[model samples]
Target chain A: MTRPDRAAIIGIGYSDISRNSGTGPGTLIARAARAAILDSGVAKEDIDGVVGVYGSDSPTVWPGYVVDSLGLPNVTWWDTAQPPSIVGLSSAAQAVLAGNCEYAVFYHGKYRWGSTSIASKGDPLRESPAHEMDPTFSNPLVSHAGSLNWAARVMRHHMDRHGSTREDFGKIAINNRTHALTNPRALFRTPIKMGDYLAAPMIDEPMSLLDMDAPVDGAMAVVVTSLERALDGPHTPVVIEAFGSGLPIGSEGNLWPEADGLAARRAVASLFGRTDYSPTDMDLAYPYDGFTILTMLWLEALFTEEGGGPELLRDAWSEDEQVLKLFGRMPMCTSGGNLSEGRATQGFGSVLEAVQQLRGTAGDRQIGGSLNTAVITNGMAATNRSTILSVS
Target chain B: MAHTRRNYDTQPYWEGCDQRELRIARCADCHTWIHFPRGVCPNCWSDDVRHEAVAGDGQVVTFSRPRVPDGAPPMVTALVALDAADGVRVLGRLEGAEPDAIRVGMPVSLDWHEEDGQLVPQFVPSGGAPA
Candidate 1:
């Protein structure tokens, strides 16, 4: 109950598919759990504790059902975390740190996104016979959250508040797409120019279609246990230096923290609080890039980079500016991320990339460095709910 | 592929859909109201929660439009962060909405939409206090 061996992530497991593998939720989660257990080098018998975050599926993928299916002793902890799974990971880490169990596993699973299970109370997103049956449904309508027109509200606020431009948004996508080539996992691997990004499709007013995470489906899982046990048990455990989740827990003045409320920098600062290492001490960080503009905001959030990170990204892709390389310096998501590579769920892909980098098994996309730590981030939809993962 | 009858999690929400009322949980303890009923008050994690009808009276807490996959977008939508118990918010497509009329703090209320045995929460401008 007093901080069990200082949890470290031992084994990372993944389902085979990076793109919508055409799998169902049950199969996807089960497969990822199986792979993680096997990769950890510990027999399933050694596992006494488990924490999980299921999505949207209520009543069906309930923890009791998962516990019964996985054949684990009566579950001590279970939570169906939404799109952003790191929030649940923080909870799981607490349980493990609390000594509820010697070894624990945290998992997030999902099927391809297109098959999203909708409530019958008329799926708000139900397709008309034309869109579904006719292979083309006219975009019925569009609107925004607290921001009025999505990030554009923020963009408006940001631009009106500062003096940025539509070009700033386009640059993030261009740079992210260019970075995709190095990542085998990104969905939009094709390189693009700033002009192409500008000329490309627009989803809502001011928000470009490419500004969104290409919806697909996939699952990702990570194993957590005491450092000693994790290191001694099997695969080299990735040390979990620190992590944090914050819900406007207090700030009531504003409603949605769309871009900044998550306080990711604060989360990362807290994670590294006890450690003497600075942001410069880590290898790379991956902030959730559900939209290109979101990632641009993350540049300042991480504190290790400049706000113009997205612009750096665009220039690196275009022959116009210095390549935004993070070699021995700032290694971001070498894995094609939700933006370019695979866009199913949020935390899974980012978590996998961190594990891959830490394990030195990143293969082709390996960044050159001591590579001891990497930060992965996830944000909930248009909401500012975000969590940070510092994997070492 | 036609999916089967989907189970509605919030019975009151669906019930409200039947009567065209936007229903919410009033934190009996805190006098705060919220949507997506949480058993415990998000403010204090206290479970002293009960139901209260939100005139859908709220502000646009957040809004967005997914115009991808083209044509089949839902009605103009925004998450109305309401003035209910503890000031909880609900996500629904705005009703009787003029594109420019939808303001971030514009006061609004509920309009219900029921289809295929399903009830959904839609919002309309909170009209003059119900006489």
Candidate 2:
């Protein structure tokens, strides 16, 4: 099949990524939406669509609230999506392509609260209801205890199956931290060695604190419009060449599937089938780094042979530069990713960084040559979304 | 707090736990085993799903020892792939083994413990408990 009508990401915006933003979710998202509209050079009255995603634990900030707060008088289409903001991006893009709306603002806001955020634990207002359990926690008997438990299990499984080591996982953390040193928005910028990662406190066996994404209070938004309309805007447009979303065939009730990387491989197949560009054609990649193991899995799914992901990751690390450059040229997650950029849930940070790289506005973290193609993969095994963007 | 609300679909599995039996949902039509019992068979869309006891003989697919707050001992949790129940995998606490002794693909057998006045299924090393 030929490529579908392209949707372009013309503008990107962000609020402060901090442990404590001292504000509500609505305010954070509104700030991001307003900045995105202004950055796109699209008049507020011309924005006819709004799309957003928020964690269930986060305070409710619906799309209608964003439209109201931004005072966008012409919101003909609006919707909210589940976690992993890539779904929201897909929704907004489809809406714009279908002529339901012209310029749509897709926003994602992450609030620090409850068990995830140490800073918000003490605040009474941030406390989620005592009985409000995440759906994963609903069935304690079957569900993996939490994200950490499932992720650690996956890590151990990878190690056992492929003979990969903790050092492999450490390379990903170190590579992300190295890139974060240049990112002003990253939560952790200090350069770390393999020893630092090994010496860190173990939250789960075989996985240290650094292996997990730092939870923070922040928001990010992007403006999506047709490729034709986006070319007339102020900034260079990052065309959405192809988008694919899918789950593993038999993944019913299974979070950590025995066949690891099944979902990612499925997503990659679906994405490549829709676009003319293969994995090698992409100059940059932003694989989700919610957990270090996930990045390893995604890299394997996208580029390397099965069980060869860690080797690729190990080879990608530049010992001299202290960053990951795929094939000694292309960089991954120059924005520090969720690992250091603070987890802006739904892979919003990855998408934002990809857009900035394509626009040639990444500032100090920008790579050497002209970047024309990027592949971004988000979410976990249960639901995965992959998008290919290029500057055409 | 434990989930006090009664769920009709999974009530039989809980009842089996009370009797120290590991029960899983098996579709009467497709014979597919469903964990965390559901109302319909995902494989065949049959409503004739019923709870049945399994041999509960399995091996560890993977395991993790997570540090609990309050300075308690680290908890060993694992996903056990059942030998009899083709595609079903169950998550539960793995008892009677030090964190270092646990390994992927270790043989384990079904066990039980009492939590919140409810009998919960756990796993212990096969043939015997760890010394």
Candidate 3:
């Protein structure tokens, strides 16, 4: 069968990210959806589909709720999926391509107290459910199965096997902070130096406070439609060149760094297979910095072979500018990423930033040369989702 | 602090811990040892899996020293790759070594400790430090 027309992201919108929004997730979702609809200049009546991501951590913001909130009367397709909005983006793109809907809105919202935010402990209204132990890995003597603990182990493992140092991880933190300085939407904009990263309190050994993403309450949404139809829209449409997801076979419960990298590698390889653009052809890249170590693994998966990420990172750092320019030209996470962007989980923040850069609207963080192609990767280990976007 | 919760698939492993044994699931058909036990064998999809005790010899793949909030001593946790279980790793607290002294790939042997009247598996340095 001949391939269908590619879908394109026509507009992007997001609410301000903060430690506390003093609003429920449903309100945040509606605000973002309205902003995205207004930004796209697409009439509310023209929208035919809606897609949103909801997780156990965030209050449910189903697509039906979005349609009702936005008063989209002609909606024929709507569905809610899991978090990391890429999954929803992919679904919207597919629906548009198949002619199921002419225009679809994809959204994801995060609540600070819904996650493991320290600030949540103080608010009685934000009290989350009791933590239940994972029966498979839990022991009565140790409580160390959480994601932070897993990242700590992965960082140590990467250092042990690849001869990378804490400074290498520090470079990622500094690079993000430097970019975040220009991002008005970023939560932590103050620049951090290598010393600050190294001196930061260690939450879990090897993974310092700066190594993790800041949890915040916010929401992001994007309007996706067929590339052909998007050409008539107001903004420059960023085409979804290709999208793919992958998981390593027989990798159930395998938290090893090697296995984690393999999953990303598989996803990226599948992604590249569907597109003409190789890793070197991209003008910018966002490899998901939910943790510093994840960015390291993603860099390796995208550019080099295994055990090569640290060296690539080391070379990407520019001491003269105190910023990271991959291979001395291409920039990563110009929107500050999750590290500084207040953890807009599921790669939504990256996608939004990529769209901005491709449209030459990233303000001071924009790349100098002609920016055409970009890659956005989300999730890790078991659920790896990737997409290649371009303004060709 | 009590952490282990018994489920139908993992009850046998907890029972083995009570007997001072480290048990993992082994497929009756493919003989593939599985950690984080599920009812069926992931490798072969065989429901004829049995919980069996192993020698509990392993090496630390990696470790972390997480800070405690209540001014308690830092906890050192390690992920161990079991010797007999192919491609199986387990998380446990590491004892008998200081945080500064701990290193990746250090030889460790499993030991059981009592937590709230329940036996929980842990690891300690064995065969001296790596040269």
Candidate 4:
């Protein structure tokens, strides 16, 4: 691969988050794009590229719709990536680095609580494994097992293989809720103790209600520009130091039953191998927490120096605040994560929060000291992408 | 029809379920088993893939009984790793035992259950057919 020109996120913006946006998807997309463009202090005409995440409910060609709505000049480069906002972000960065475009804006918009539930009303299942697992399928056991059930099966296997308990999972939920208390944007600001986590209604056995991420209607956007241009921009530029995306060793034939935290280790190796920094260098890290088990899996995968296991997770949640905030130790999910902060646009929520921390704009939830670098994992399973970012 | 949305690749798999036989794609080149019914062999990337019948006996890798509303009784839902098809796990209902009695690695044989006007693949204790 040719060495691409360096790129950095110059600005990040988000719409008012809530259970219901009470607006159309197009409105949300336009609102977020405008906010990001304004925040970057870059002219709208300069945004030559517009990339977005395309889910079933989203338009087949999102950039065309967004550009028209925002009244921006015809972008030289534009495309929509399916799911896993990482693909969209990577596309935008590639356009910028290749000089196809100067300023690029990547936005994710979803209406989970709108009048029409997007999951039920979106495009029909088309050639995806997730479709075969639907309840109407001839497989009764998995018919009922949606993503939650699959994650539960993985969690059970993790317990059987590595001696992780339900309480160990509970500790992760508790820690996320604890962190959410300071985040006003968080949906579940009310404190949840170990009792609450254990006693909460079970969605899938081994995965209680608390372990799942609450879906909300919201949008988030990030502006990517050349590193040289970012230096002249408004906020601290979170430079993309290194990135890698791929499937893990065990994710091949089946998804959940045989799945393990090692699914992304290969990608993790490539990510850390390319960068000068190790996992120890990150002052903050955001592991994809679509499910709490996912967060634990990412923590174990990237932080192998500290030994990747559930025991480490249990200790991290149990440790004192000073130790939690220490450089080399547990610096994960500081924005309360998906579990508490509301699952805002899938992977973009975590990336948005990491950028905030690196820019010293995280407000009440900011980590102390000179925060230089952060690591973030976007997507899951075969579509995973891990990125390292820093303020240089 | 139990499933009205199946495409060409998946329709036959569901049809095999109706016949009370467990069929999975096998690589004609390497004999590697593929679950979830795909076009090519994941192991070898071989295009010589054909759906073949197998002894549907497998061990329960993991099981769950989600507390949700449905017509069927609270049956043990398990991810079964087939004996004939190593590393190929399929999700099916575990029958002929209490939900709480099921354990990981326990032997289970292929079976079928009818619900929502569809015949679905299920598993029962290997000792005998599901009663």
Candidate 5:
């Protein structure tokens, strides 16, 4: 029961990776699920589980719709997850390990955000219900719509405490963009300098347009099965060594802990506590990059060191070999992340990237040399979920 | 635009807002304050809670100014922590103050605005309390 290694991600696949998918969300989810099943070399009859964080843009892409559209026969385990999800995959993994289902398909799909209005239910407009009501018993004010303002406030708070600068955030943007150039599926392949990030127009004070996720229309899927089942698959199985689903601490007072550090720290503790693997054992860290600030937070949260999340990120991307040595050879966000790779895939895309890395199939953007362990995360705030994946 | 949808638990708060008064639920036994209008007390598992008016004064916990392209003009909002209420926070627009001037811990008082025939509460600098 202790060895969760019984579960592994055997297949990774996706629909079109573009701004405009030109198809219904159900179609996208089905196509990606089909590709994943095909890639796993598993017959559709062997599949009995389906879990996905479908439709950040539309609710029509629910489990029932997907089950019906994909013609999945007798799904024993099926459920829908909240949008921008990373924890949904854990549910699938748990189902596999528990023997509730033999093969589980975790997938998500969404349409391009063309002139889509920002202020909506799950956005910043609703601040974790607990923090939204006034004790004075007055009518509550509608909160702001986007993450930019929240991110800016967190940045300002981080700056106030640690003396981190806009340049630090710019460095993260530049690093993700740098990796994007090598990822053909990335929405933005053009290389950008730190100067470009600093010069970008301010969407919110201290947060420029460059610091945000480029919304797009796309879908991604991954197949999770028992190691016994995965061993028979077409590619190397990425073992789910350990995982931590920490609660997100939205905002502490006015200042945010750097990278939602509290949640990241908790997730780190849970991860390292369960397994012998340390951050040093990791070949890469696929911290969620819905925004540049998150990447900084993830690095700080997962690294064994106390402070210097920002400093480490800056050095990791720095061309100076002496400064880069501080990171000890852990590369990050190999898929260009959501910032450059398009936000529609949610966090499932990162899992797909981790599979590609472990199998040594990541063409140009590959990290090269020995690839073993990867640390993948959903956005740390609201939900802090991280998983350690390694070649089995 | 502001809108109010009254449910079984939230009716009292909305009713208080309709009367231009600020009210919150307090547990009679433990004297604990509950936020967002819940039926039972979160403290001591007591249902002995009643809605009562309180001073609308509070301090800003955090504020953000988002770029709303089409609807509102230069919106600045905040999560405010009540002065005397424990663990009670409210979200409101920070009106009558420059977006750049808003900071955490700045004193604020409740105010009101109307949208779609619904009264929505807002926050302003304590110095500019609404009459």
Candidate 6:
């Protein structure tokens, strides 16, 4: 990896977004980029790479075009992927490693609400996985049973094996929203109790609304540069110690009845192999929760620490009787993940949260300790994309 | 389960249902074979590749029989790593997949259907049949 000392996130930026980009894409992208440039503490002239991806019906406004309109320097590279913010990050990493550019800018802003509805119309079966379980395939076409339902099935099996429940699952959302109370950006600021979660509307038989992440119209951007370049920027820089991505191979034979290990484990191993850091090394948890059960499944997949779901719930949510009994540690979703807080136009908000925590700029939602290690699992499909970031 | 019209992308493979034959792609670059789809090999990462028909004589690297059926007529599927190529693998419907008969490294050959314009791929025990 002779890629110029690689890259580290030096600054982060996000736009004030909501259900409707009442303001539209132009306004949202501008705001998100401005936040990124200012946060990076480096001049706007420094960003040479802008990568992004979007799935929408509106007119295509490529990231490079957005970069040009911003009156910033010429972009050496630009790319996009579906809703997974980390996909953009992955592309950015390749661009950095391939020596395509030095300072990079990644952002996405879209009307996430309408995207789902429009998406469902196309090859309805193609997008149906998000809404219902395809019993025809014996796999979920959509819903908790949808998409990566196999991962949840794995979690359910583990829970029964380890003695856990929907209530234990509630600890994750409960603790996340508790953190959201202080985040003005959070759309669902209404502090929730575990009971409140258990009572929420059910999406799948066992997964409830609280378990699934709510969608919002927001865009976030992150600035990355060489380690030497980072120190010269606004704040002390945190490097991306490792980022690993796994392509969906569907090796389980049956997506319905999963046996032994989950497919993403193969991918998780790839990332850990790169940096050799485990879950215990990270002080804060940023498990991707496109759906609630995924958070539980991810905790077990990380294997950076011991214990699975109940233990994870207990570690992050101490006040709850269910979690306390399991003996878990490491705070989860302190900025109120995509669930309690609102999901943004682009998925980059998760990575942006790590920057906030690392820079101690997380405002009222500030996590207690100076976050040294942060693990972010960012993809949503059966495919798992994850990265472990640390203060070097 | 609804006889949901299967997506045409895989009709070639499923069409091989009645007569057993397994379909795969052979690349022009390294004279190696592969499956799924590719103008190139994922292993060699080359675009200089061609699709050549071959007899699906492969060994079962690993397989799982679904107790209950899933997709098409509830049958077992196996990941076949072919002997013809290095590191080339494909998933195919298994025929005569008796619990006792199936074993890792079991020798199998292609038997398939050429339906609706596709060289659909399927598998049967080696020497039992060939397409």
* iRMS of each prediction: 10.8, 12.7, 12.9, 12.5, 13.7, 14.1
Order the candidates by lDDT, highest first — what do you get? 3, 2, 4, 5, 6, 1
| Model 4: CA > 4 A from native | A1-148, A248-256, A305-307, A319-329, B2-4, B43-46, B70-72, B128-131
What tens-digit string does per-residue lDDT give for candidate 6 at B25-83? 45466665543332324334344545444566898654544333235343445556677
Task: Between candidates 2 and 4, name the one with more favorable lDDT.
Answer: 2
For model 4, residues A1-392, the per-residue Cα lDDT tens digits are 34556989997877666654443344456667777887999876677677888765442324544554454553445556887778888888886785545688998866542224555334332322232133112232346332235777777776777777777777677777777788776788887777887899887787778888887988878888899999998888889887754333334223454433554555566678667788777878777777777776777777753225566765565444521332335467777788876777576667878898889998988888888888888656534667888986
Q: Please state every model's RMSD to the true fold in angstroms.
A: 12.3, 12.6, 12.8, 12.5, 13.0, 14.2
For candidate 5, give the lDDT of residue A172: 72
- Displacement of residue B60 (Cα, Å) in model 3 is 0.4
> Candidate 2 chain A — worst ten consecutive residues by lDDT sum?
A129-138
Task: TM-score winner between 1 and 2, please give it.
Answer: 2
The Cα error of candidate 2 at residue A161, in Å, is 0.6
Cα displacement (angstroms), candidate 2, residue A210, comes to 1.1
Candidates sorted on TM-score, descending:
2, 3, 4, 5, 1, 6
DockQ of candidate 1 (2 decimals) = 0.18
Q: List the residue pairs that clash in candidate 4.
A: A248-A263
Worst lDDT 10-window in candidate 3 chain A = A132-141
Off by over 4 Å in 3: A1-148, A250-255, B1-3, B127-131
Taken over the whole model, the C-alpha lDDT of each candidate is 0.52, 0.73, 0.74, 0.66, 0.65, 0.55
User: In candidate 6, which residue ranges exceed 4 Å CA deviation?
Assistant: A1-163, A251-261, A304-307, A320-329, A345-347, B1-8, B12-131
| Highest TM-score scorer | 2
Tens-digit per-residue lDDT, B9-108, candidate 3: 4567778888999888788998978565544454444547688888878888888788877877667878888887877777788877767888888888
Model 6 TM-score relative to the real fold = 0.51
lDDT digits (tens) for residues A1-392 of candidate 6: 34665667877887776643333343355557667867888676666666665554321335533443354543434556666678778887777876555677877665443335664344422222121233122221111111232333444444545576877778777776777777666677787876788788744334556766776777666778898888888786978877664323223322322322353454466567666676667777777766666666566667523236566555546674322212355666666778755656223556777778877888876767557878887643333457777775
Lowest-sum lDDT 10-residue window in model 5 chain A? A128-137
Q: Write the per-residue lDDT of candidate 2 for residues A117-165, one digit (tens) a residue.
A: 6765666434442322332112445533323357788888888999888
Worst lDDT 10-window in candidate 4 chain A: A128-137
Q: How many pairs of residues in model 3 come into backbone collision? A: 1
User: How well does each candidate superpose onto the true structure, as a TM-score?
Assistant: 0.58, 0.75, 0.74, 0.72, 0.69, 0.51
